[model samples]
Target: MKNRIFILSILASLGFLSSCSDSYLQEDYSDPTLISYDESTIRTNQDLQKFIRGLYSRLGTSSFSGDYFTYQELTGDLGFVSARNSGYFINTNAENHLVVDGGASSGIWSSLYNTISNANLILSYEGKVPDNPNGGVTSKALFAHAKVIRAYNYLALLGLFSPNYGEGDQSLGVPYSTTYNIEAKLPRETVPKVVDNVIADLTSSLADFESDNASAIFTNNNSFNANAIKLLLARTYLYKKDYQKAIQFADQVIDLGGELVGGGTNTGNTTFSTIFTILGENNPEILFQIEYNNIIPSNNNLQAYWGTSGAYKQNFMAKAFWDDFPSTDVRKSNVAWYQNNATTYPDDPKPINVKKYLNGPRDVILLRKTEAFFIKAEAQYHINPATAFTTLKNWVTTHRDQAYSKSLTGTAVLDEILRQKGFEFFLEGMRFTDMKRNNKAIVKVQKANNVPLGEIPVGDRRFIWPIPLSEIQTNPNIKQAPNY
Candidate 1:
């Protein structure tokens, strides 16, 4: 039997508790309904192909324990609300972890491990593929794809669970499980080290998959192709503050001939809707996206971003930076909701509810070309402002000039650059992370109830959300984030 620790690591995000038994991780399923891994029936190529599709199906769930749902749901500038409170939901801008809140907590808690376990399930069965028809040396290709997804899931997990990048390898992090065994539950590695493992997994994944799958196979850009995988690597390294690697990888994505558009960049018949729309898999700007149908299949972030009583409604943008958007910029043309009407006693409605994922159509937030550009610009500026400014100005003007009345250029350009980013991303589950990374502040000008917006206070410990309380309790191996 596999060790209990490893099993929990695999099922940790699946809402499954280990209690004391380790077999849960390695337990062979008797139910034909649940992923059937019978080595005997897997004789034909089609059978092996079926297994691969099962892997894909598992990776593509609404409440997936993976990065897409978690990042959009947790960590960002918003907060989840009391489920009983008129179904009110929003990304509360507080650092207090919400492990006990049953609804919001479960998605953040169970989805990623559900994602991670599926990857391991794929990895565990790959060696046996030769017995199956769909089993070619491509088994290695499938394995790499699964690992890339796993790496993406971990990146999201670390964004919320792990602390700073400087903590290096010694900083506490999540356990490592490749074989899906329960016994091998790895202890907490440091944040930096955890990142190292992510890099290592990604490194292997890239090496194995790139030559084979750079151009996405499906019409919907859901799977992790080479370029998309590269983009994720850049994002991961950027979080780690490994500027050179971040730049290197981001450059690779840019070289693929894609760039961020849509901020007055694209001109023509239709302008971007201020409310939720434009999430389909076909958008040119979308380099990669998690595919979902509004009704049948799940598009997790959609509910959060465009949901009525959903979390997005709760996380409407703060007016603190609203004026930052250029007046002429069509990008500001109501892409989200902010109340212009004021009631008696100075009551104005919430402002920042970005409708990027509304029900009209489409799917998840795409890894846009703009994000890659911003990452490169930020990476450059971190070490040298002049070079960074030049790169940024060029990107902004060449890419964003369509909407803006004037071009931005000056010493104080970071805000301008970030301002566009705010417009480009906003509620895409990135604002909070960007705020933290760029060393920007998260101020509350007035009290929670007070309508007044806050000042620009530096991002502090409160800025880095505490790890959810449940993890600390169950996994004594991990420590609570400081000041929790």
Candidate 2:
């Protein structure tokens, strides 16, 4: 099968060319801007930093910005788009949930690949940056940062598209594009190979950061730095099923000591509301986020999709998920609200609206310390159940449900951790992957106006998304996901 691979032209990366025209092989090209910039365009640290910022800009607008989270939430058991409105039909089913081309889909596959391709281009110029005689550290740091971006993008692709690393592993993996060769039709590597590549990139990048003794190259958690890198390590290890390694890295972050959920607030009933009230680039808990500079002209999709005052509104909580929370659970109070025939879905019987994203132009959190603690808890459960339950109890009791006391042991302990993660992360986009990772059957048995629409069993093919049709048409080596 052939999959379409969109490659940005070299001139376009230099910020000159606008769009490509047909019949490019005529050889009488008259684009002057493309001819001006050469190897010297990115020789210094300033030039490299500017290019890096451009890569970050791509991240801001990509499907992962807020669209990815929205799609994930609706498809998961925690939330569902109303069946009354055919407009949200794509989000209602597994088949059209996310796509590589066109209309209402998340459009993540292409957006991520574009960013990856650009990172590859920037990395190709690593040698061009002059080495500092004092230590050659600045040039090395720049190169390492580029690797971090590449690794981050690749991991995002793997998480959504490819199967889990262990038993759920699909032999096929997304193409690892590490070069700026547009004509290159790279085949999908195996799942292990993809994981290895990400680990290799992060490992090398961490080494470079240590060599320069640079703990942080960027501030405000807006860019990838040493701290963010460690968080990524913890998350990656968790996905890879390396419980011990995941715990080790999570410990590093925990020991470093920062606020739990973005600010130095007590983890009581007020924790969720307080932290979200002031969420921004400088939030202490955020290890990495997509930042918006201005508060007034915010283009963040979260504000529109989840924001209470914003125009668009179709997303609502699954009642079963809401009912799972204790009556006094602060997360339930802070994260969602009962909107009775208010706007959008009038047919919904007091449908729950997510309130976490009410204010925007706020930073879109990609990683936070709260998640680190949860990762540690889950990892510990697999290693030592007693200690894991203790950790889980302490964290949840203090931060989440104040009255929460459940003597969970064995498999129940793991279930509790997953459940806590669902409540904490909520719509920040971890639900689908978490369910899949644990091989949990998605039982959306809630009666939405007395309708039983969702009940996906384990080993169901719909759980895995189809490879975008465009990809299958252009890249001859690409294979669609099994049972797609």
Model 2 alpha-carbon miss at residue 364, Å: 0.7
Per residue, candidate 2 scores C-alpha lDDT tens digits across 1-484 of 0111122233233242111321222233255334333456676765565566556666666776776787666667776555443354333433344444443323677788877877887888877788555453377787787798889888877776777886665576788867876667777778778888898899888888767744333445667777678878888888888989989888888877754532235454324454444443465677777655443223455666552455566556665566677766666644433322334554344456666656665667788888888889888887888889999898877766678888988988888888888867877878877887778887753324444456667887656666777777778887777775
TM-score for candidate 2, residues paired by index: 0.83
| Prediction 2 global C-alpha lDDT | 0.66
User: In candidate 1, which residue ranges exceed 4 Å CA deviation?
Assistant: 1-48, 62-91, 94-106, 131-137, 167-169, 183-185, 214-217, 258-260, 263-280, 294-301, 304-314, 333-353, 402-413, 444-470
Writing each residue's lDDT as its tens digit, candidate 1 over 1-484 gives 2233333333332222121332323444334244324335344433444444444455555344123433443344332222222333323423343434343444654567666776776567666655334333355666677778778778777765555577433465665567664334356666776688889988988887765442232445655666777888899888888889999999987887645344544443223442134432454555666545533334544455432435443334444455566544445543423332212212132343344454523456546656788888878767777777777767655655445444344436666666667656655667656766666665432123432342335534544444555555566665554455
Would you give me the overall lDDT of model 1? 0.54
lDDT against the true structure, per candidate, is 0.54, 0.66
Q: Model 2: how large is the Cα RMSD against the reference?
A: 6.7
Q: Could you estimate the TM-score for every candidate?
A: 0.75, 0.83
